[model samples]
Target chain A: MLENIISELEKQFQLEAVDHNSSDLVFLTIDRDHAVMAIDLLKWKFGYKHFVLLTAVDFLEEGKFQLTYILNNPDTKTDIGVRVRIDREDANMVSAHHLWPTVATYQRELKEMFGIDFPGSPRLNDPFILEGWEGTPPYRRDFDTKAFAASFYHQREGRTTNDPATYMKEKLYPNE
Target chain B: MSKKEFFPMDGDRTKYPEIKSDGTADIDLSSHKYIKLWHGPNHPGITGNMAVELTLCGDEVVEGITHVGYLHRGFEKLMERRKYIQNFPLVCRIAVPEPDYNEYNYATCIENLTGIDVPEKGMWLRTLTLEMARLQGFLMWIGGMAGAIGFGTVGQWANYCRDLVLDRFEELTGGRIYHIYILPGGVRNDIPEGFKDRMEKNLREIEGFMKDIRRAFFDNYVFKKRSVGVGYIDPAWVFDYGIVGPNARAAGFKHDIRKNYPYAKYAELDFEITTAKDSDIYTRAFLRFEELLKDIDLIRQILDKMPEKGDHISKVSNMMNLKIPAGETYVRSECTRGEYGYYLVADGSEYPRRVNVRGPSYTHGVALLEKMLVNVNIADVAQLMVSLHTYPPEIER
Candidate 1:
């Protein structure tokens, strides 16, 4: 089933390097323009009806936002993650709302959380899952939550800031 | 059958104007008859920390919009920053009523990414914890549904019965609400001695209450009248909106993750995928009641069949230095609400690159709620919302 999806994606989307390294997960990097088309094919032709999830992973080092659309075929019980990397400067992609209406909410959430834009979706600009008065998209790696919290909310008088990883390293592996 | 024939509207077929191609209804909400009302954030009818904005024409809701984020803690972001082990305790709080599913999903995702194999006893223990969580979640749903419709006594009864399950949980996991038992390698510890007997006794006691539950809630004429046709989800929309668990089963769509994609020793269990034909509030409630019975049986099977003496957790080299190789996986479990999936991306570092939690309520609470609320009576709004079984924290997360 996964091989069939990979070949079909290659044939239709044309000239794409796909990553199938993960078990039970297929990652296809498609052009930002063909994201909706790829998803439509997966839905109508490939029997991937379940739009499981849509999320963005920010790779600050790569200077791109990798938008992943997780689709599931109930018959095969296979999950396919379609990833499209868009320029961080121009973080925009065609919305998958036309293929699945639920994507509107997911896209709206992505827009609010990652500062991504889905121009064609309904309520694309609506405040979704987040209220007004935002500084940066909090989900992005560049947005330091600790600094933001310290500035916006109250903190203990003498409490020192500590990274969770560093704190765990010191507490758990002191001898090492 | 054609769309028009199957979905027969009351208006004249020929003379009735066609719906606009853009899918917008030509209705004016600014008229004097239309009144806007907010149904929650604090409303008892609402399930959790969320609200629905309803545009009502007299008693019928013309349009409804779900408003969330009252409980948004940015769990995904928090998980990304925290070490893998630190996330176990935090994920449980994502879903208040049923925290074990989140814990299970988180652990399973990490295990899948890290290629950590749990022992046989661990798998059985994990399954037991998941089922126990489902029982308590179903009990909470019963209470919420009954309370929503003003059936206070059943709510109290179900909550009391649920406390028995929690007592067992506290005895085993050291916490009643947030067990934090299911870890990445396996469970936190083995079931305490005499735990099986105590759990069986509790299950038998709850089973004894089943008759009264059926009589008071399921068979009550008022409940039947209020819920029979109050929130009917068309079977056609089941897959379109990605409804699962009891809601989809109640709609006659036999899609259970436990049966279809078994995880955590579910393949060894012998149970039927219970379903109902009617996709209404009543059927949804009845389906949950039926599932509670099945869950009791499942717990009994796990307790009886589990290995008597074995290691509950596989030994990890070190907690602080543990780093999963770079990989991505979507691990899901048959949560009480539905298919709760955790999409994990590891970056070969201490912290996860990204963690996206696909809670079932994200679809049920927001998209499906907004779509189903149109033309529904204002009185049945909360009833229908509770029937969908949405937890707002899951949605906001």
Candidate 2:
């Protein structure tokens, strides 16, 4: 079932890469421009009607943001994750709201959390899950959460916090 | 003269023009009437910590906008920094009412990434716990729905029944609200001695209450009149709005993660998907009631079919030094509300690279609520919101 979906997707678009990570999971990477087209093909041509999830992963060293769109077919119970890589400096992609209107909320969320721009989406720049947030997008790898917490939130004083690895080492090899 | 003299101010307004002249009395007769109203954030009718900004024309809403994030803690970022085992307790906090779905999804995702296979008894135990949690959530939903519609007694009865279920949980898991019982390899512990008998006793007690619940709540004519044809959702909008769970089932769409994409021991269970065609508050309520009954039957089947005794937790490496293989997987579970999925990315490190919770409430609470609120009667706002079963923590997270 998954193979059929993958072959159909590959036949239609020039997929940059396609890999099967595990059973019932298919990963396909395409250029940012073909994201909407690929998703439309998957939704209409293939029977993947459910828009399961949409999220972003920040790769600071690579200087790119990986946008994953997960679609599920109810009949086959298979999930196909469409991957699109956008430039970190100018993180922009076409909106999938035309296909699935609920993507507007997810796009709005990504815009707020990762600074990704979904140009044609409604309320793209609206504040979502963050009010008056004026710093680097919190989910980006470069954003220092510890530093942010120290400056903004109250921290307990006179208490030492150790890294998990350090704590594990001290506890496991106390005699050493 | 006698009636008018008794209450002079109650006469026709235009006949008695002096009443209109008073400073305190003012009436505007306009074709277009627009009043801005804020519906929540702390309102009793609100399901959780979220608000709807509604523009109403007299009694009909013109437009509605959802405002969330009153409970945002950036759980995704927080989980990314915490160790694998450290995240088990925190994931359940994402969905407060039904925490087992979150725990199961997170545990399964990690187990998938780490290549750990749970034993047969462990699978049955997880399924049992999942169904138990679903019943508890349905009980809470019944209470909330009844409360929304001015039936306070039903809420009390439902809460009492739910408390009995929680008592069983407290006995087995040692925690009432947040069990944190599901771990990566399997459940935290096996069921105690005579736990099944106690659970069956509670189930029978709930079964006894079902008849009274039907008589008082479901069979009442006032509830039917108030709920039927109210909060109508067209079947076409189900896909566009990402509706799921009982809401979609009420719309005559047979989309259930348990039946469609069976997880844990659901594949082995014998149960039918319950649905309705009305797509209104009444149908949703009916579907939840029927699903609750189905859950009871499912729990019985799980208990009967489970192995007598086996290892609940499979042997795994030390949790403190556990490192998952570098991979990404989207694991989904049939939560009480809908399809709750977790998109986990592991970079072979002590901490997760990213953990994105795809909460069903995110769509139901914000997008669908905003869309359905348009032109709806103001009286049905709370009914519509609760019928969708929106959990705000999932939305904000």
Candidate 3:
């Protein structure tokens, strides 16, 4: 059933990769430019109408961010995850809010958290979780959370870590 | 079937900031015709710490900007650093009213990524707890829904009824609010002795209270007047906005995750999906009430079908350092409010590469609420919000 979608899609655009995770779920990779068009095809032509989610994963070592758009078909009960890779340094992509209005919210979060830019998405500049966050997008791998916390807050004195086995042996069964 | 033919909405799009082709109205603050009002972060009408900035023209709201992040704990970023097993305790904090959905989805995602087998008894126990969570979640929502419209008596009765279900949870999982019971490979423990009988007793008492609530809340003229046609969720918005659970069900959509994408013991259990065609505040509230009763029957079915004695947990070799392969999968369950999902990405490391917590409220509360709030009377904002059954933590998380 999913093979038909892959074949049909391959005719119009170049297929980067196709993964059949399960009977009802399939993940397909395509170039960033054709990503939105492929998703549009899946929605109108294939009936994958329900917009599940749009999330980005930062691969700092490779200097790339993989954006995954998961769309579900309520009628056929199948899911298609379209994966697109974009450069992390100057991250930008086509806005899909035209397809799903709620995609603007996802795009907003992506813009605020990963420094990704969706030019035409509404409220793309407004903060999602943080109102005026100025530092590097916190979700990026290069952004060290421990360093951020250590620099911003103070550690309380006399706080210590103890291995449960060693601490239990020293306190409960001292002679054992 | 257009609802306009049956019951005309309370008000059509009022004259105010003109709506654009994209279904959004720009709030022009400079105009003296409109006044801005902040509807919470502290108000009881809202489920969690969140506020709506309502742009009002007299008593009608022209535009509502949803403001979240007041309660942002940043669990997603925190999960990126924590080990696989370490995040078990933290996932349940995502949704306070019903936390088991988070635990179940997170655990199931981990199991799927690592290819771990959960015992049958464990699956049954997980189902029992999830249904119990749904029952309690709906009970709490009823309290909020009734209280939103000044029906305080029903709220009190609903809370008391909810305490009965929490008592059952206390006995089974050893905690009232956060059970942390459903683990990755299976469950934390076996069912307690006489737990079924105790739960059955509570279910009967709850059923009795539900009947009383139906009379006091649903049948009342004030509730009907305030909610009957107050907020109508267009059936077309079901797929557009990713609406799920009772919200979509109330819109006459038979799209229940447990039925469409069966998981746990739901495939073995028999139940009907609750649905209605009205798609208004009253219809959604009443649909949820009916679903609350169905949950009681499902609890009974689980108790009857469960095995007598068996393994409830599978042992993982290492507790502290469990490394998962590079894979990504999305696991979801039919939660009380809607379809709660966990999208996990593991990069062959002890720490999860990325974890996206998908709460049904992410759509219903923020974007949909903002859209629905336009042109609605200020007085009905709370009632309309409660009808949507949104939890703010899910949005900010």
Best-matching candidate per DockQ: 3
Q: Per-residue lDDT tens digits of candidate 3, residues B30-82?
A: 97888989999899888778999988988888889899999888899889989
| Model 3: per-residue Cα lDDT at residue B56 | 90
Clashes in model 2: which pairs?
none
The CAPRI category of model 2 is medium
The sequence of per-residue lDDT tens digits that candidate 1 reaches over residues A93-164 is 887787777889988888989999988899888786877847788888999888898998987789688999
For candidate 3, lDDT tens digit of each residue in A1-176?
Answer: 78888899999999898877778888888999999999999999999999999999988889999999999988888888899999998899999998998999999999998999999899999978888898898888888888898988998799799999899989999898
For candidate 1, what is the DockQ-based docking class?
A: acceptable
Error of 3 at B215 (Å): 0.4
Backbone-clash count (model 1) = 0
**Better-scoring candidate (DockQ), 2 or 3:** 3
**Two-chain DockQ for model 1:** 0.48
- TM-scores for every candidate against the unseen true structure: 0.92, 0.90, 0.94
**lDDT, residue B199, model 1:** 95
How well is each residue in A1-176 modelled by candidate 2, as lDDT tens digits? 78877787777777897768677888889889887898898899787888988999877778989999999887777889999999999999999998988999999999999999988788888887888999899888889988998999887789788999989988999887
CA shift of B84, model 3, Å:
0.5
lDDT of 2 at A142: 86
Ten-residue stretch with the least lDDT total in model 3 chain B: B1-10
